[model samples]
Target: MHRLSRALLRALPRAPLLRQPPGPGRLLPAALRPGSRGGLSTRPRREPPAAPQRPAAQGPGGEEEQFVFPEYVAEPGPAPAREPPAAPGRPERRPREKRQHRVTGRPDPSVPPSGVSCSGCGAELHCRDPAVPGYLPSEKYRSLMGGQPGGSEGQGALGRVVCQRCWLLVHHQQALHMQVSREQYRNLVSAALRSPPRHGRRPLVLYMVDMLDLPDSVLQDLPQLVGAGSNILVVGNKVDLLPGDSPDYLKRFRKQLLRSCAHVGILPAAQGTGGQVARTGSQNLVDVHLISAKTGYGVEELISKLQRSWKCNGDVYLVGATNSGKSTLFNTLLQSDYCKSKASEVISRATISPWPGTTLNLLKFPIINPTSDRLFRRQERLKAEAEKTEEQLSDDEQKYLKCLKKQGYLIGRVGRTFQQQKSKAVIEFDPDELSFSMEEEPVFSSNKPKERVEFTYNELKDARWFFDTPGIVKENCVLNLLTEKEVKLVLPTHAIVPRTFVLKPGMVLFLGALGRIDYLQGAKSSWFSVVASNLLPVHVTTLEKADSIYQKHAGKTLLKVPMGGEERMKEFPPLIPQEITLEGIGTLEAVADIKLSSAGWVAITAHLEDKLQLRAYTPEGTTLIIRKPPLLPHIVDIKGNRIRGSASYRTKKPPPLVENLKANGTNKQIKRVSKI
Candidate 1:
């Protein structure tokens, strides 16, 4: 019966299958088709044809009209061009306009905004790359831009913003590593100098150099950079780091510094005629003042000189090499009468650290107008304070001065005028801000945390500014190769205590692993006084074993500085030796100074007839300078009797602190504690 049925179906001429209309009772497709296997066959379902529209009525002209549905209408433009297919395993990039924004609809904060810069370093603010200068994290940037919790509420908060680098330096005493070339630093300074001043006046350049580092800190071509006609005030910073308080020593040091400056072409070479000053180009060395930015020694005189010589004629720029105390001086000046009273209250402090390249940008504060009225008020305040004897001073003032005496011999306190005192009372002090005052000594304890002062923009837009330019990185500075921890060990915090050692021929002295001095040839034993941070340990050994000892002790506790043991030593540059020959002037005087980069210097003292030949070793690529007429010629006298069994000498006690102040045409003396 099945075969008969199949034959009958096949004979029916194989009628074409018709799709059922859309309805609830649509029949299922037959499982087996005629002349096919008895199994269900898969087929694509077809869509129903669209319904036709009714015809439109004829017009008065009696012509029949056609009708069209809205769905059938085509767009009235050219088709969009298709994008090419992406390559294998790569993401397809979309147009920037169609891409999602990083922060809401706003532009990326990592891209610097127009006319915006960090208040601390003056680098253009960006949040993109931490490896670059002026990098701030996005969240912190949002806070600075008023988009997050700690952000500024208005334009007034602009001056408070600092880049992450400066923030880390100022608060955590940590520094971010950045690879900035010396040429790049020069370009930054050149660009700043090329910019026209706001009032169209020549700017005064305050050329600063480290007292300890000598020529390395002195810029040889300063006159050329600041314009030959510009006035330059050569400032010697970190005087407190040099031992001895004798006024005569300071005078001699100043003369030696001037000569050194001349040697480096910063000043003109001395003429053969007499002790007459010669002109180099049109630039004049306005004056050379040695000051301790940390202890405020000679800072007041510096400010007075600024007011007297330069006045408010133009803006003042502080320029120097890296780790030369430029930022410290800036901070000191900001709180003193040098800065405008209103501006000082609003301006932020620069980041001061032992790390090289700490100041990578131009920071500025408005200079105070040294008008007769303001000068008179300042003089009166100083006179009032000077009139008071040590007995007359308040207990707090007495205690503060006592503490300062231990830090330096010549300390100057920042005195505020009546108006400033009155204004200070009205302004509320933020407890969270860093406590900076002439009275407060620096505390290094980690347990007692300190905070940074918040700042804002100065309202006095017309006032002249005191610019703090980026420090020029010295090519041969040892600090450049040191880690932050090692730097702190090398840089002096407290007053340096001169450590003298008696060395004979064939003997070697090591200043940690940073410097090595060998008395290779000498007629008699000589006194080698070390002028360096007390934190550096001085080890005396025979020249024969010097290399072996250094290799074994470097990066260990014996040679403290590069303190990561074998791992650190592997990366550290090997010590390179340089031969130096010097003639002795006198036994009491230091005939020459062997400068071991920024690590420290060794002042050699020998008999008048002694002609000493020495070999000095420093890290590869570091500077090894032989400074004649040593900075402190009488440094040998500053130590106590030699130790009985060792090559070391006892550190002499610091001299008594005395302040000579003139009051009512009479000189008055203020006494502080004699010893710690």
Candidate 2:
């Protein structure tokens, strides 16, 4: 019956799962019922509980179901520090008491037995450490301390006793963590001595410089840092940011870098040519290499150098600025796995955020060489010491001090001056305040010029005056005078209106009465205005004694004021002569009014026929108004075009002496008559 029931259920399309079968096998045992206990019911007996229904067996097309289950993670707690047995032969020195003593033999207090000889004058050590007598912390002790200071809740609850020598040594080895003083930096021979790492020998030192920031001032002291024998390789690390991939562009960059170094005082390494090293004049004894850390392009060359040169597998110590990717390079070198087991370690005290200084007091590890056992060290310890010293010193000392103090001061003092230099201030007239008049109308020889719009006005009875008024504000407030390029003031967007000036032909305008006053030989005098006026392309006439001209020479030379109603010329007798001395030159009256009909125009004709060669008409192939016409000025064939006839002697206006010879004479005849 059960087999037949199962077979029938398998054939059904969508049947609800039953919790229990209404059969003898589905009933619970009699012992489980409270009614069966002692043949009496303690509570009313209920039907037996049904079993949980199972979902249908899943296949490729089955509806997937998920359920949240609590995960049980069994984390093994903090492991105890492993105690490696001390080496067999080398006897460990007994801890000595703290003692203060003078240093004599060696320059560096932290130098090993090998480098302890005096750099200044070769001498053997009298006291243990060269610079000072101090104790260094043991590797075991540093691990025990775990960066916890001698205070509450530390591994050393009572703070373990350490000698000054041991502590200094430990600090030197852990230079990456220590802040070195300026005194320490200056006195020490090598960075290693100041902050030696656990490694025994010097590693191939890579000196990375930000090309833009390196000044000769800072680079002068570079030789002292790495020393003479230690292979100091210089690398300009941001080559990727340089402009363009062209060989010429790269050459320019290299030349600029070399020149900048020379300016600040760094010598570069040997240059390569045609894929071979060549001796160049600018090459320094110090090796120089260019690389871009941003892209991992030249890093392999740097790694190859590190692998080849560093002795006793010396530590690859990268030292540079905060943003220089020192840590990134470090991580890359070590394949990013820092901890022996865990993914990351918690750094307690950080010099900077996100990136922390090396925390290991003396990170010791051993590597085997083909010949014997060796240790490869990455000495970030000295960098740590340098950082400490850097913090203690003023901020600019590392970067800008040399630039400001040495180069800036030198350049500033090279050319000294005692006498005050004269300065110029330009004066401009307000268009509204100006009034113009022409004594005579300008008559064109040709058909009325289509390019030039001409106008005429009556001559001025009084001498023209030009004034220098400062900028005007909306409230009638005037701002100080602004230079040509300067913006006087920012106006409210809605209130501001741009000004325009119109120049009319054959018109002389009286500006305001003012002249620029400047300093000369410490005295307030007008000289710059005089000198600068000569420099300006625009014609400017001084008005220092112009008023005298109105009193002296008014209407002397056929001057006339044409009234609108009469159109008559009124002749006046001379109050004074035409010439007067002011500023520097003995200036004469400008008989005719001046006007600029056009701002200026250059006719761009192609000469498509090629018959004229363009030169027959224009000397420059395009004419300057002051030099040639269709403008007023007479045209002289400067090139003297062989194809065209010699230019006629035509003048824009005849000279003042010849204006009276034939007032109605043609301009060409007037020019010829004046020349004769």
Candidate 3:
């Protein structure tokens, strides 16, 4: 009978599921009850006795069909600290107590051992575990800590003491990554500003800015934190990614930078006929220099300038947001091919890597050149002497020429005496030579040299001493938003070759599945140019297909925005959408640029006919910033054919601003269906 009943149900069309009440109401209507002639019950006319009410039971799907409410959890309390047990033979090392200044080396009757800072990476030294940073073997740590600076004649006595991790990284170019928090960065910036320097040296602040990711708001914060006593030198790093050599573009960029800095209360340097700063009406003093630490472009001149200006022994503090190239710049500043630091000899422990937070602790390296101010004075004397003819010289000048002859700086030699008198390979300086060329090849810090120093930050004596601090984790930068591989795709290692697209109404452009731009409604076909890492992929699709393509290919192929690999990244989060409406300041100005946080931006070329509308999409919690194109040269170029349909393209476009668009969408979707 049971088999026959199952067969009959299968033979019949599917019936709708029904909810039955408790007690007498539990019985379905005679016509609708199961096992009835027609899904109805004839025997159900007899009802059961009253019973205690119970929680509702699920239907056929059981627990799979029902949702259980999760228990609420309160906020987390302060973390508890645990100390690992010690092994025999080697005693357990306790957490380091606070100490006096590493630079001053003056022991506070208050603190002991000055808590070990890795002479290599500057992390506090420890021997508890090899997996953690600043780890050293117990015996090695004792030997290093017990030794004195310049203990013996050999370089090993004065060798740099690095953690085992830094030693491996320097030798093998490996990365032992760390996740740094923003609060730690705030502490470092505060310390850099408030920490007193050695007696005679003034604190010269080098605030490094990542040219590609610098926002206007960050520029403003620089002045407030760096107190008025310090002179601020802004280094716009990663010029290797900036495009073009057009004077017109540079002219525009200079003005834009000046304007932005002025907006932030940081003024350009005081103006003279040939002064570095032009009167761009700003309150605080600043000098800007564009450099490429990766390529060693413009760094030499910057070094010479800084070294010449502050003749007084001044402490140079390198401060910048994470991935701002501060470590690279710091390394380059200390690189010397001369006798002291050889290409094969190990020197600094400041770790340089694409991985954010690679630098955990503050590290310092002293570049105590025996002849300091004398090098600059000699260069000045040589330049003056080089400009004069042999007959145009006085007896004193002749004596100088004779000295230059001894130093091999004659009419044929251009930069033979450049680095210094004590430096192994000197600059060959010839009177007729227009450019200064090094006698030996130029050395770069990127070349991982063998280990050399055992010294700490204590050896620096006020002479442009470089203090490397922790990297600040930026919240919106694609580097922070994307995973390690994704960051490589988004950050340009070489010059950025640009990509551009032309989209009609209803078309959308997906930037490596990380971001999307919908051309909701425009006067005509819209042209959008993109400038970012050449390695990052871009794709386009209709608004209807964009959602499906993104949902399907997200992490597998469109891998830019996903935070990690595996199923989590493949499950692209639903985009948090926003509609941007643009308006022009001028009657004729209708176009504007919209930025996608650390991702590149798009400039909308709109007609005055109607205000353009743009719908932007990004992962939830990710910041999407819209601003005018920055005053950067070659941020965008229209030098490519319009890309349409489902293909991706590249072009160069600078980031800044545009105008006149009406945003049309809910936070979830635009929901606008315009005429096709």
Best by TM-score: 1
What TM-score number comes out for model 1? Answer: 0.73
**What are the Cα lDDT values of the candidates?**
0.71, 0.27, 0.54
Better structure of 2 and 3 per lDDT = 3
Report how far residue 586 has shifted in candidate 1, in Å.
Answer: 3.3
Ranking by lDDT: 1, 3, 2
How do the residues 148-167 of candidate 3 rate in per-residue lDDT, one tens digit apiece? 32234322432456766666
Native-vs-model 3 lDDT? 0.54
Write down the lDDT that model 1 would get. Answer: 0.71
Give the alpha carbon lDDT tens digit for every residue of 204-247 in model 1.
78888888888777777665667656667888887765666354
What TM-score should be assigned to candidate 3? 0.60
Reference-based lDDT, residue 183, model 2: 41
Every model's TM-score: 0.73, 0.25, 0.60
Worst 10 residues of 2 by lDDT: 408-417
